[model samples]
Target: MIVASVPRTWFEEAVVVFFDVVRGTRAEAGQVLLPDGRALPGVRLVEGEHLAPGAVYEAEDEDGRRQDPERLRIVERRAGSDPAVRLEHVLGDEGTVTVVEGALQGIERPVAAQLRGSVRGLGRWGSLRRVHGEARVGLRAWWEAAAGRHVSGTPFEARLEHRLAEATVWAVPRPHGAGRWKVRLELSLRGRSFLRPVAAVALLLFRNRLREAFTDRVDRLAQVWNEIVLDTVSQDKSRLRERILDAAASPPEEPLL
Candidate 1:
C-alpha cells in the first residue's frame, strides 16, 4: 500500500514544465473566441450537457486513434465577453477531463485554473486533476487512484498499474517581458509498496533525461500555439477555425531524447 502523506518518504519522480513565450500574448485567446467574446464564425460547439451559466463541451471527435480527448470545440453562446467555457478533455479510453472553473480565462492567459477528470480503463481512477495556474503563486493538487486488474486488450493496449499513490503538478510563471512569461512546470509522483525504492532509484538516476523530454514536449506545444496566434491578422473565422483544428489534429511530435 502507498501512503498518501510524506511521499518524499516513498518512491518519487519529478518533472518541470519550463518554457518561454516568444510569440504569444493575452489577446491571442481571441483566436478561439473573439476579443469581444463570441465563437468564431461557422464554429460549432462540441456536444455536452448544459448547466445554468455555461454548458459543458467534450471532444467527441471519433477519428484515427482517438485515445485522449484532445479534440476541438468552439466556444459559443456564452455570457458576456471572456465568458467562462467548460472544456471536457477525453482521457484514455473511458475518461473525461473537465475544466469546471476558472479555466476558460486560462485559454488566453495563465490564471487560476481548476481542471478535474475521471479515468476508468485498467481500473477506476477518479479525480485526476491539474487545478491551478496562478502566476505568482504555485499550483497544488491532491490525487488518489485505484489499481488496475485484469486489463485486457490488443497487444498494444496498456495494462496500466494502479500504483500511483499520489501525484501533483504545479505551474509557476513570472513575467519575462512585454507579453512574455517564464513558466516552470513541476510534476511529482509517488509509487506504492515494493515499487517505491526500486522505481524511485531508477527514475532519479535518469532524472535529467526526463527533464529533457518534458522540455522538448513543451517546446513543441508552444510552437503550435504560436502558429495559431501569429497567423495573418484577419477576422476570417473560417481561417481561424481551420488553424485551431489543424493544431489539434496534428499533435506535437513525440518527445525525442
Candidate 2:
C-alpha cells in the first residue's frame, strides 16, 4: 500500500514565494534562524531544482534512475531583503494543481515510512507495529507544532511560527510478497503557507544574517530528525527485513499474466 499526501493551489503559490526569496538571497545576504534560537552567518541563495514545498522524490529502480513522475519545479527570489528568501513548487495532477510555500523542500522521510509501516504491520505484529504507531503519533504532534498553530503578530513572527514539519513515513511493497515491506521516514512540512512565517521570523530574529543562518537551521533540523529515524529503525526485526529483500529479489508478475 502507498499512502501519499499533497497540498492544494495556495500551497503551490507559497512554494513560489519561497524560491523567490532564496533567489533574493543569492543577490544578497539575509537573516535566518538556528536551532538554538540564535542567529548564524548569512549566505547567498545559490542553487535549487525540482523540489518545492509539499513534494518528495524516490529512487524507484535499482540504479536509482527512475524518479517520481510528479517532479517539483523550483525557483529562488528575494535574497537581499530581510525575509530575503522564497522557494516555490507546483504540485498535484496536471489540471487541478496547487502551490505550497515553505523555506525549502523537507517532507519525504515520514511519507516513505508511513507507506511501508502500514504494510509491514499488516504482515507482522510486534516492534514494527509499535515503531510505526509511534511514528504516526509523532508526526501528528510535529504537525501541530509547525503547521497547525498560527503564529500571529508581525508578519515575520507569524511566518517563523511554522518553519519545521513533522516526520513523514514511506513504504515500498514487495511486488511478490504480501508480508514483505521496506519502510523509511523523514521529517516534512505539510502546511502550505508556513514559509511566510518562517521568512518573517528570519527577518526579525536573524535580521541581516538570514542566509547562512537559514541554511544552518535547515541542516541541523535534518541531522537531528535523521538521527531519530535511524535510531528507531535500529531495532527492526530481521525477519521483516529479510522478507523485504526476498520480495525485492523476486518482483511481481507482469500485467499480461
Candidate 3:
C-alpha cells in the first residue's frame, strides 16, 4: 500500500504481470542482448520458462563479470494470490544457504515477509567453522510510498520468531506525510539454552548501536528501492519487459538510467 493511489486493482494487475517480468530474466534462445547491443554470454535457461520449480540456469558470477560461474536452480515457486520463489546458491553437493525461506503475503497487496535462514559458515573461518549455531529468524518488513497528499502504509505486528543471538525482523510502513514515511525496525535476541548468557551480554552491549546502524542502512535502501520504482514507472509502459530484461542482464551497480 505504499503508493497512495494504488488500490486493490493495481495490486492485482501487478500480480498478474509479475511473472512476465520475471520471465524476462531468462536468456531467451540462450543469449541476452543488452540495450546497447552488447551480447551477454554464459547465461541461459536450461529448463522450464525459467520460472517453474527445478528450472536451472547456468550463469557466471555477477552475470559473467566474475570469472567463477555457478548453476542456480529454482528450488521452489508458489503462484497465486500470495506468491514467492526461492533459488539455491548451488555449491557442489550441499546448499550452504539452503534452509532459507521467505514469503510475501497480504489480503490485497504485499504487506509482510518472513525468513528463517542460516549464517553459520558465512565468515568461513576454519577455527570457528565448528561453532555452528544457525540463525533462524522471521521478519515482517514494510514498504511505503506517496502518490498525492498522503503516504500509504501497511501494518504489521513486528513479531519475530527467533532462536539465536538475534531475532527475526519485519516492517510496516507508518506514514509521516507526502513523499515521507517512517519505518520502525525492531530486533529481539533470544539465544539457545547454552548461549543465552552470551547473547544477553552482547545485546546489552551493542543493541542500541546496532539499531542505529541498521536504521540508517534501511533508510538508504528504501531510497534506492523507491528510485528504481519511480524510474521504472516513468518509462514507456510497453517497454516494461525490455527494461526488466536489460536491467537483469546488466552487471551490478549499473542503472538503466
Task: Using TM-score, give the best candidate's number.
Answer: 3
For all predicted structures, in order, the TM-scores are 0.38, 0.19, 0.59
In candidate 1, stretches whose alpha carbon ends up further than 4 angstroms from where it belongs are: 1-111, 122-162, 165-167, 232-257
lDDT of 3 by residue, 1-257 (tens): 23222233444445445555553343456454444445555555656654688777665444434333345667888876666666665443332333345566643555545443433333344223322222211112233322222333333433333344435454444565654455555555567667898877877898889778876777787777677656655566666556656655556553111
Candidate 2 vs. true structure, TM-score: 0.19
Pairs with steric clashes in candidate 1: 17-185, 69-90, 147-162
How many clashes would you count in candidate 3? 6
Q: RMSD (Cα, Å) of candidate 1? A: 16.3
Worst 10 residues of 2 by lDDT: 111-120
lDDT-wise, the better of 1 and 3 is 3
Assess the local accuracy of residue 189 in candidate 2 as a C-alpha lDDT between 0 and 100: 29
Q: What's every prediction's RMSD, in angstroms?
A: 16.3, 23.2, 6.8
In model 2, what is the error at residue 241, expressed in angstroms?
A: 31
Query: Candidate 3 versus the native: TM-score?
Result: 0.59
TM-score of 1: 0.38
Candidates' lDDT values, in order?
Answer: 0.35, 0.30, 0.50
